[model samples]
Target: MHAIVLVGGKATRLWPRTRWQPKALVKIGHYSILEIIIRRLRDCGFDRITLCIAHLGDMIKDEFGDGRHLGVAVDYCAEERPLGTAAPLHLVPDWTSPAVVMNGDILTTIDFADLHRQHTTSGNLLTVAFHKSLLHAGVGVLRVRDGRVQQIWEKPNVEWNINAGIYVADPRVRDHIPRSDAADMPGLINALLADGQQVTGYGFSGQWYDIGTPFRYQKAMKEFLTHPDRYLRPDAPSNGNGRRNEVALEPDGDRLSVADLSPWS
Candidate 1:
């Protein structure tokens, strides 16, 4: 199966660290986030991969050069400008088989092969990977009717199924994306849903991290440092001392205020 990995975000939330480098090049452990994603895709039996790149794209091209070292045939789809998320699908070559599309900065142990199997057999136009997330209100809340307080709920937790930045789509799914404008994944999914197309969400529970912000980057670094084995492949080669050397976390800089520029919801 072909995997279209989107590695072309400005990553404004990561600030000065990503000011000169692409988010894909950010190091989590010993390997860059892009390398880890490629290795995982290869392990999942995806032999052909396409990287949609922009924002210091040359560095990413220089680093992964043909993907020979990673045991996969690598190809690239360069974006002249920021094309949201789903718009890039229109830039990539058409596919006859189901293709997996995901953000390149995600750190997860998701089983792509299983995802593909489910997507293909279900006969859905699109299958999105979803993870359960909880949002907690930081302060107490009150409900009032007219001049009287009806009820109050303090610090309630809201549960939601979040899009995990991964998707398996049929070839026809591309028809919904606009050819000359910015269109996001949420918009595309909504279009499909409004047209009565079959769209389903596959739920997963495991180690998943979206390394887009400083908080998430630091969290992923700490998780990999503490539980290196969970992030590393079992077949990965070990040092002569029979242990894998963990990569040091990069130093944190002053936090920068980032606008909500996420293309995906």
Candidate 2:
């Protein structure tokens, strides 16, 4: 199956590090986040991949030229201006078949083949990957009736199924996205739902991380170091070494500073 990876965001939240480069080039161990994502897609038998790039797109083009090294055919759709998440789908070339669309910064072990199969057979225009996330209240909560407290639950946990930034979209869904202006995925989904089009959510129970911020990046690094086998390819030499690979960071007294490690190292 074909796939479209969105790597266009400025990623301002990951400032300083992202100030100079796109988040797609952010390193996790010896591989950049984009490399890991491409490798994952290749492993799942996706032969055709297209990257929708805007910010610092030239760097990405220079890094993964033609995708030949990764054993997949790679193409690029360079947006002249920033197009939000789902709008870039309209830029994909010959995107007549059902395809996988996802964020470039996400690190997950989700099975893409299964998602493709489910979407194809279910007759839905769109199938979104979802994960259950817990929302914890910071302060105490109380149930009051007639100005009298009947029950009190402190720091309650609310379980919510959130969008996992991955989607299987039918070719027809592209019609919903405007040709001009920016559009996000949530807006697309809501439009589909409002029109009574079939939109399904596929829940996955696996390791998933959206490395959009420094905290999340560090957390993903730690998890990947702790359990490399779960995230790395079976043949990856670092999978079973049980060793912590050094990332591109060094101690700056009490703080940490970015180091100049080769992204492909």
Candidate 3:
């Protein structure tokens, strides 16, 4: 399967860090966000990857070059002007079916293959990945409508689901995106909903984080450090024997064997 990542956002929320590098290049623990996504997608049997880039497009191309080093071939669709999330997918020429699309700012362990399979077999125009969130408690005082005193309510938490900004979209859906620079994903979804297209939501109950803001970017790194096993791809080596610096890569042949090298150490 082929995958396209929307890496074009300027990431103004992450100013200084993003001033020097694109959000996709922003570090989360040991690897950049783009690298993590690309590696995970490759592990899930996706070999062809295309990055949609606008701001600092060259930096992304220079950093990952051909995707060869990451065990996946890379291609790029540079948006001359910032084309909103779903619009850029229209730039790819030979996309025959629904393709995996994801935001470059996320750090996740979602199985892309599963998400894609759900979209294809279900015959939906689009598939969205969402996560159920647990809300935190808050303290508040309430007044009664009658003369009787109203009860005080303590902080309470709630649960809800939110869009994770990853999608598997049918190529036919591209027609819904407008030809404007400011067009975004929300507008596309609203159009699909109004048009009565079959858009299904796929729930992912696993590790996922959007490193869009400074707080989230930092928090993600700390979280990964604490629970490295949950975030890093299983194909990547573990720090099981107190060795937290090396990863085994078969750059040549495709077999599950390890050859140790001190490249990063």
Candidate 4:
């Protein structure tokens, strides 16, 4: 199946480090973030990949040309201008099937195969992966009746299903996107809702991290290092010995075969 990874953003939050390289190129242990994501997706059956890139896109193109090194057919869709999140979908050439769309900066053990299966069965135009995030209303929140306070919650912690930056969208769904302005996933979902199209959510309990900041990147790296096996599947191809610096790409001491993209080393 086809998968599109959005790696175009400037990632302004991750300045200095990102000032030099895109967030997807940032490394966790020995593997670049995007490389790891590709491997996981490959394990689950996503063979055709398209990288949606803008800022430092040439560098990304240089890093994984044709995706042959990673055992996947990797191509790119360069954004001539900044197209927010969902807007880049227009540039993905030839839309025939439902493709998995996600940001390149996330680290999660989401089962892409399962996600696709669910989407096929449900016949939804759009299916987004969701994670439970705690919404903290930091300031005083009061529900008053004219003048009397009916309810007041201080620093309330509400659980909400947040978009996990991952989606399985039908080819027809792209019809909802307008070519005029930059758009994001939220706007697309709202438009679909207005059109009465089916949109579903798939929640995962596995580890999920967004490495858009230094602290979060460090923390995610630590977590992945602590339990590398949990996130990487055994199905992806590995280099000889398959053993990288720390993470075991193969189980039972067997290693996933990978080409030594010396530059990455």
RMSD of each: 10.3, 12.2, 14.1, 13.1
Cα lDDT of model 4 by residue, 1-265, tens digit: 9999999999999898899999899999988999989998888898999999999999999999999988899988989899898999999987689999999999887778877878777788998887654456577555555576655556555545556899999988779998888999899999999998868777665568888788999999998897777568633322211100222122111111121111232
Return whichever of 3 and 4 wins on lDDT: 4
Assess each prediction's global lDDT (C-alpha) against the native.
Answer: 0.77, 0.80, 0.75, 0.79
Task: Work out how many backbone clashes candidate 3 has.
Answer: 1
What's the TM-score of every candidate structure?
A: 0.80, 0.81, 0.80, 0.81
Candidate maximizing lDDT: 2
lDDT of 1 by residue, 11-108 (tens): 99998999999999999879899888888888878998889998999999999999998899888988898999899887786567889999998987
Taking all chains together, the TM-score of candidate 2 against the true structure is 0.81
In model 3, state the lDDT of residue 152: 34
Candidate 1 lDDT (Cα, whole model)? Answer: 0.77
Task: Name the lDDT of candidate 4.
Answer: 0.79
Task: Candidate 1: give the clashing pairs.
Answer: none
Instruction: Tell me how far the alpha carbon of residue 101 in candidate 3 is from the true structure, in angstroms, after superposition.
Output: 0.8
Whole-model lDDT, model 2:
0.80
